[model samples]
Target: MSHTANKDALAQGTHHLIIDGIEQYYHVMGEGPVCIVHSGGPGVRWDYLRMPLIEAFLKLIYLEPIGTGASGRLADPRGYTLARYTRHVDALIDHLAVGTVYFLGHSHGGFVGLRYALDHLQRLSGLILYDTSPTTGPEFGQSIEEALQRFAARHSIRPEVPKLLAAVRRVFAAEAQAAATDEDATRELQQIFPVYFADYWGREREFAPLRESVWAWSDPLRGQEPEPYDVRGELGRIAARTLVLAGQEDAICVPSWAQVLHAGLPVSQLVVLPHSGHFGHLEEPHAFASAVRNFVS
Candidate 1:
């Protein structure tokens, strides 16, 4: 089927698509070749990655994963598996008839993008991984704990916050094992979202733009990643010109994981955002957009 925009000429510039009987929404911005962007969030909003700077260099197609933004809700949380998301992207690619798209995914979206390249490498011309990991090991979890502890030692974070942090991880682990969605789990995630930024409290305004945007959470896909996300063995399967961007202080995806993720891709360049966290693109928009522009051009 042709992309929804084709259904009506008036629909041009509107970001919406019908995938698998549900109407899904994705924003289309800028001009030139398409660079499909997958926003982070097993259920996060796509508005965060709408970087005009990058759009100036390459056309950007941002996807709203199920349960968030204008996308349809999944009937079954179990359907939120990594493979399922990869397929959603595949269907979107076909539905749009945009050949050999340049895929860019952030956080969880990066995982899906990497998976897509592994099986459908022929359909991808290049790949961009922003603040993501190749695998989720006990080490990554431990590192987050350690970082929190270290941060506490210096900043004296509220005592109750630590308990909340533990609860956050528990919620994540539980949902991952069950492969389901829970609004309660999502609330817990938003509660400790600050841990994602280098200066969550101090640099509050830096995230102001997103403050007004609708940040929705779905319990199905992200938390329900059935297995430990270990794509290390399959990294070599990606053959596109890959650009790996990591935040130097990213506690969640961590720079160390990015280092190894970069090392595994045969053709890849790693750019560590010297002073940013998971939302490195926001923290360093100019540099971030320039990196993307330089790579694609």
Candidate 2:
């Protein structure tokens, strides 16, 4: 389909195509070089990654991704792996007929983007790894734990800090067991969202809507891969120029993780949004958009 057709399809809500016997839905906005965006969460909904600012300068293609939002579910939710997500990206590029597009991934979506780039480097013009890390295991967990401790310490004065921290523990525990239901995951994610911000309480008026609006589901297979997710050894192979964006105070994907990615990727730039957390695109929209715009341009 042509770019015009893609826009028209998005105008109605979202555009989708059948890939590997499943529906792959995506949202397109703005106009310029086509940039395909993959939101985070093995189960989090895609709305949280919407970049209206970046849309002003690029044709943003946001994937709903399998097992999320309006997209088709897998026969087994555990089937939502990076490989599967990468295949959908490959197909989406082919379906869009926009060869060598810019690819952006946030959080878990960054993992998907990295897999796609490593597997299909020839199909990409550039890559943006936002709020993501190069690996997930003990080290990553340690960093997150440290970050969370800092967050708790920083916000300890607030009456709600303890509950938020409790929710974080509960969610992580549930994720480890792959036992959370969609409703349960969604509620826990919302309750603990303040931990994701540099100052969510300070800016509750601006960020609360996103906290309340967040949605998630459980993927029984998630985090159960035989091997821990690590691509440090493979990062050298990705020749596409990359923008490694991170939030300075991000608890989940800390600046240290972004630094690791920046150090590994040969041709890359690192931009850490100073006053933001995991959701820099929302907390520091202008900086996030400018970094992306400059990188793509």
Candidate 3:
């Protein structure tokens, strides 16, 4: 299927950037305070966050990370790291001629946004982290299990734990073992949405139709990570005021990571939205938008 474009998006138009003979894409909307919103996936596009109320809170500048959406792919491919993504945003800010801006990076986008803020604190007014963790490791351990256990409080673990866990692990191993490890494998991970949402079983169908617009071939980056893969050490360097948003039920970027981020940053606030999953912006739009508006105000 062709990627869906929001042609009727209120007051919005597609934009582009060309560097190193590679063209990149980003969408701009609204006329409020400037806020750049980066979507999840080191490989996925920003198609999922185009809600109406988001525009009401702030001017939304949706950046299409290189190799995804309508953007050009890097020739080296190794340049697909979070640091490269940070540079993409850097160029956008200069190209657009913006003074100070607010950045809202969701999931992997949050990883990029965090890196960008730490390096260019002077140009940022605030940082908004949603459904993202500072680093990767045990901190992101089987979030599906964590999400389930959250629902069954007094219990140490969910009764269906063994089978559910084995199944999730099998999928991960299968993807890793595949003959080809590409962004399309990241696309296949979408089929396992049950592990991503608060109530995947109940809302499985509602989640199916919504698919990734573009799946860039960048999983090679997911595999070449440092041992601990933890960025807690650098969180203190994020001088920009920060807002950490977590879905109390999000298994992907669990709320515990949010707490860690809150504790690390010199100045930050944590808000765990109730009954939300990784996609809290979509699951609870009004509340998410309000939190963003208040924080940036």
What lDDT would each prediction earn against the true structure?
Answer: 0.75, 0.85, 0.72
- Overall local distance difference test of candidate 3: 0.72
Candidates, ranked, lDDT = 2, 1, 3
Which residue pairs show backbone clashes in model 3? none
* Candidate whose lDDT is highest: 2
What is the lDDT, from 0 to 100, of the residue 224 in candidate 3?
A: 37
- Backbone clashes (count) for model 2: 0
Residue 293 in model 1: shift from native, Å?
A: 1.0
Q: Write the per-residue lDDT of candidate 2 for residues 17-46, one digit (tens) a residue.
A: 999899988887887888889988777899
C-alpha lDDT of residue 104 in model 3:
91
Clashing pairs in 1: 181-219
Write candidate 1's Cα lDDT for 162-219 as tens digits. Answer: 7756765665463344323455545555666776777666777766445444365655
Estimate, for each residue in 165-216, the C-alpha lDDT of model 3 and write its tens digit. 4555655442454315565455555544455666654664776666443343
For residue 297, model 3's alpha carbon misses the true position, in angstroms, by 1.5
Q: What is the C-alpha RMSD of each candidate to the true structure, in Å?
A: 3.4, 2.3, 6.1
Instruction: Name the best candidate (by TM-score).
Output: 2
Candidate 1 regions with alpha-carbon error over 4 angstroms:
1-12, 157-164, 173-186, 208-214, 221-226
Off by over 4 Å in 3: 1-11, 142-167, 170-187, 211-228
TM-scores of the candidates are: 0.86, 0.94, 0.82
10 residues in a row with least lDDT, candidate 3: 1-10
- Candidate 2: which stretches are off by over 4 Å? 1-13, 173-175, 220-226
